[model samples]
Target: MLPGNVMEIMASPSSLFSAYASFSGSMMLVRTMVNDIIPRPVQAYLWQAIRRLFKANPPVQEHLTLVVEEYFHGQNEIFDAAEIYLRSKIDANTDRLKISKSSDEGVLVSFAKDETILDTFDGVELKWKFVTVTTRRQRRVSYDEGEESQEQYFELSFDKKHKDKIIGSYVPFVIEKSSELKGKEKVLKMFTFGGYGRSWSSVDLQHPSTFDTLAMEPEQKKAVMNDLDRFLGRREFYKRVGRAWKRGYLLHGPPGTGKSSLVAAMANYLKFNVYDLQLSNIRSDSQLRELLLETGNSSILVIEDIDCSIDLPERSAPTQKDPRSELTLSGLLNFIDGLWSSCGDERIIVFTTNHVEKLDPALLRPGRMDMHIHMSYCMYHSFKLLAANYLGIPDTDDENHCHRRVFTEIKGLLAKTQVTPAEVAEELMKSEDPHVALDGLVKLLKQKKRETPADGKLETVEEIEDQLKEKVKIE
Candidate 1:
């Protein structure tokens, strides 16, 4: 029959409904039977083919993903900086936060794992996801030893079209910002070595010494301060000169002449950490190099009593050996002025000695020790400072008769004999009373004067060396 006639016959009310129900049931039965009879592989192939035939094409888009692993090349500096920058951007959008304690910066706040944040820079959209993956490893045992290790990474996605801008401009900007934040938030830490050939230990530095409180001659103090200021401010200048952005200082004086105190003052002035290197503890040149490499930039590397620390041989004496130390004089010189010294920037190396004349002349060369500071005995101006520091004598009160008389007497005694600033400070600290302290200091000065030689002159370097040798022998 013709299609129109057949449809009209079937359109009768009762027949049409029954015919439609029967057709639907028959199709469902056929579908179930076919599905049961077909092998899984054949079904899957058919389904995939159907999907490919009907599926529409996706929109045209390009994406680039950059992954920053937590530990790259065994150092976390770049990763940490990236985390700091990404966390700051993510913090505003993410509700979940992770808080942790840090030894250097105290409390730290970051984004929680699996949190995704959207950010935009330079008209390009970027997405950052804080992801942490836990991996379980099996160990050899009867019982299953599930060792779970966590790995953290930041996945950054941006449009491929803006890849160059993102890599060249945005990333560098983030690093610079991170450095600025670190400079503002992080506290300076002082590191020191303990025991023989052990790793460095650190603590929060809390020294309160400063140039103002330091008892020294006014001119000398000013010069030291100026040199420090210049060194700190000349990062670009050092680079222009093709130098290592480092400065060396040679502080020479007798014992108890405020060398250590001066180092503390320098640390405080620059807000830099002090790495008090004990060369005796270091066993070899390799260990020393490792320590220097590990030290952060903008730190002071101090070697106190360098003369006594090791047998630093003269340049001419290459065969001389120190049985107590394996590190040679050449190795030390290399540590100071060699290729490895360029590993860090904005560094200050200070070598203090009680007997500078006995030191190797190579160490005193111009390039090795840039500034040779002579921390001499207490002078008139230094005594005045010590008095003011201990007894609260105002520098402007020159008109006070008692103060003037005490100052004149102290100056005369200081001229007649040479006593260390430490001795004068110790005497001034004997009493809290201003007059008593000043009078006690004067008495100590007179005692020192009487003990001076018949010529009333300061001890020569030879005499001081002889006394040191005798003292060492007695000890």
Candidate 2:
């Protein structure tokens, strides 16, 4: 049925090869023309349509997935933010979740492993899945080290079109929202260094101290609060000025002048954790640096009784034949204001001492201790606060306050007598009735006034106690 020339071409090898070559050349030319004429979007659309035509069902969306791991080198910031941000999105539909609690914060809830959470941001729906994979490996370092561990991560998926929005806006929004939530439910922690290992352990700080309950001068309290507010609000300013975002305070006074109480109040006011570092326990500068580095940001490091903690050699001292420990005053100063100080941000350093005069001039400089607060003897204003706190006495200005008459007498004695707020608070705690407590405080003040020397100057309470102890030793 075929034509004579076509049948001859098909049967002959040379003729068939020539025909195949011509056909391939024509197909290549047609493909090149189509590629050059059609836009990539249109080509893709056509390709997808052609593929979908043969399939029973097709995927409805072009999805892009991002993996956020829990720890790479250290704890991952994005993973933490995601964990906090997604807690608000855990609806009743979520099958499982993790719940935790601290002493202060009632409860904290989060996602459990393999759980999925659906969230919408800026009208775009995103799917988040908490993934966990467990595996085993050889522990070459130590036999006690765990050979098996779980790796945790989050898989965030969304349509491919909103990649830029998810990265640029939504991710940042999540971080900001997490920060806000953290601020709202922050539970204060008290960290202390244990012997050896140079690590820190923490406990919930439940000290019932606040700015409202502290017995301090009104002006001093206001100044401290304002300074804290300014420091917190000046993160960008610190960056612009090329300085470490930190503040330092030196609290110097007698033992009973509420230095520790003041520190507690500051922690409660700013919602910052406290790291109480004892220098005597530290063996070397490296250990000190490690301890300080272990402390997190937005924390306070307190060196209490710094005068008695260690005998820091003067900078001018000559090198000895052999030093006992590598810890030096210069190293401490460096940690305070040197290059190491910039390792973290939003930090505060506090040094408390009974004798500021014993400290080196280098340690008392402006950058090292930005603010030096002298916790003086109790005054009438302080006593009023104590009265209000302990005996339920109303404000001094209240006309009907039953303690107003006693307050005037106590005010006169407090001006002449040198008594600490702690001493006064102790007196106020003796009796539940305001009148009886106020009367006892008056008697204590009169007794202290009578003991005052003729020159109207006397040794500090600590010095007098030391003298009495010496006398007892002599006896």
Candidate 3:
């Protein structure tokens, strides 16, 4: 019935395929136009009607879900925190670990999809589900040229009865725990300056010192630990009192009396990084402030030998300007207590000196240093602690007569001699044999006593400084 050319064209495979594709495309265009022309309310009603006609209702769940999107108001902190918390739970519960590369840390672990976990807080039950959504979009020019994207999120569900508590208390608690976990997982960093105008260099801090290992009076150690705990716990109190959330410690002691060890111990206890600020290495007041600004929260800033670190001119003394010295006592004081100090929270500043009396009156003032710790000469109790640590002597029992005798002699010698902990520790390390170590310690104590003046007087700061300079010259 048709012409030969028309029959050939209709029978061609390419022409038939093209006609089918054109029909499909025209139908899609018509559907899109209809959707665009329809009012949103009418379209929604039609969609609901269509769904009701063909789709089954989902089963009701007793708990309501709260979805935390990855990006909210251009910040991902909440999403990140939730991911961390959930990942920890998943790691504990599941066998497989999902690993991803991170810019800050080399690698990070997270939960894989289809993993459901249950978490409890303050006797309330909550469930978290890891969901992965994959969406495909076709290009306008070609259907094959399209993009696929995957979005991940966490679905947290809890009973309606716990809605208020979960929002108010549990969320904040999770954030805090997440922060603490992150800190604990990271390596502790220790920073030190090379010289004036030089930047700080960092190393992995591997200090073995702890409150239990440091040789000090038990009561004093307890007091220091308590004070540190109070400081860590009193952020709200500090804010309420209109004070910077920082604490200053003044450690005054003779050389080799465990001041440095105490600083290390504090860092270990608090899990804080230490920035050993060599005051002499700092060139100017502005540099000092910059260094302080560079430091992060939950860190200890230490200035050792504070009395000798700088030539702080007295307020009444004549001003002799030193071109090299730009860091004045006033500037230093301002860095400690001024507006700059309020930049970070949970910070601690420590100053160590051999001579408390030689320190300026302003430095010794009450409000300047919150706590003044006097690291005294090795006492009997401290010696006992050292013995336990070095020789494995148990403080619990005095059953062994040899150990008892050694303890008694050491106690007597310690009362008479002002032996340093460093000296005692060194003597203890000389021999693995407990008896030999104790005997060597006693001999060293006797030798020190014999060398001392009749009044058993200790060298003053000025005398010590002179001896140090002489020693340096000899070296």
Candidate with maximal TM-score? 2
Q: What tens digits encode model 1's per-residue C-alpha lDDT throughout 111-218?
A: 787888787888889888889886666655646855555667888899898999999998888789888877766555688865332245566676666898887767
**Residue-pair clashes per candidate, as listed?**
0, 0, 0
10 residues in a row with least lDDT, candidate 2? 466-475
Which model, 2 or 3, shows the larger TM-score? 2
How much lDDT does each candidate structure score?
Answer: 0.77, 0.82, 0.77
lDDT string, candidate 2, 1-475, tens digits: 9999988888999998888999999999988998999988999999898888888776678999999976544236688688878887888899998876755457767778899999999999999999977665555577664445456789999999999999999999999999998776765779876544325556668888889999887777777888889899999999998999999998888789999999999999888899999898887777787777767778899999998899877666887634445678988998999999998889999999999898888988788898888787887788888888998877667767666677778877876778999999999899998778888989999999889566778655455334333322100
- Residue pairs in clash, model 1: none
Supply candidate 3's per-residue lDDT for 277. 87
lDDT of 3 by residue, 96-181 (tens): 55675533345666677767878999998898877877666665777594665455667889987789999999889888878887
Candidate 1 has a TM-score of 0.62
Q: How many angstroms is residue 150 displaced in model 1 relative to the true structure, after the best TM-score fit? A: 21
Q: Which candidate comes out best when scored by lDDT?
A: 2
Model 2, global lDDT = 0.82
Residue pairs whose backbone atoms clash in candidate 2 = none
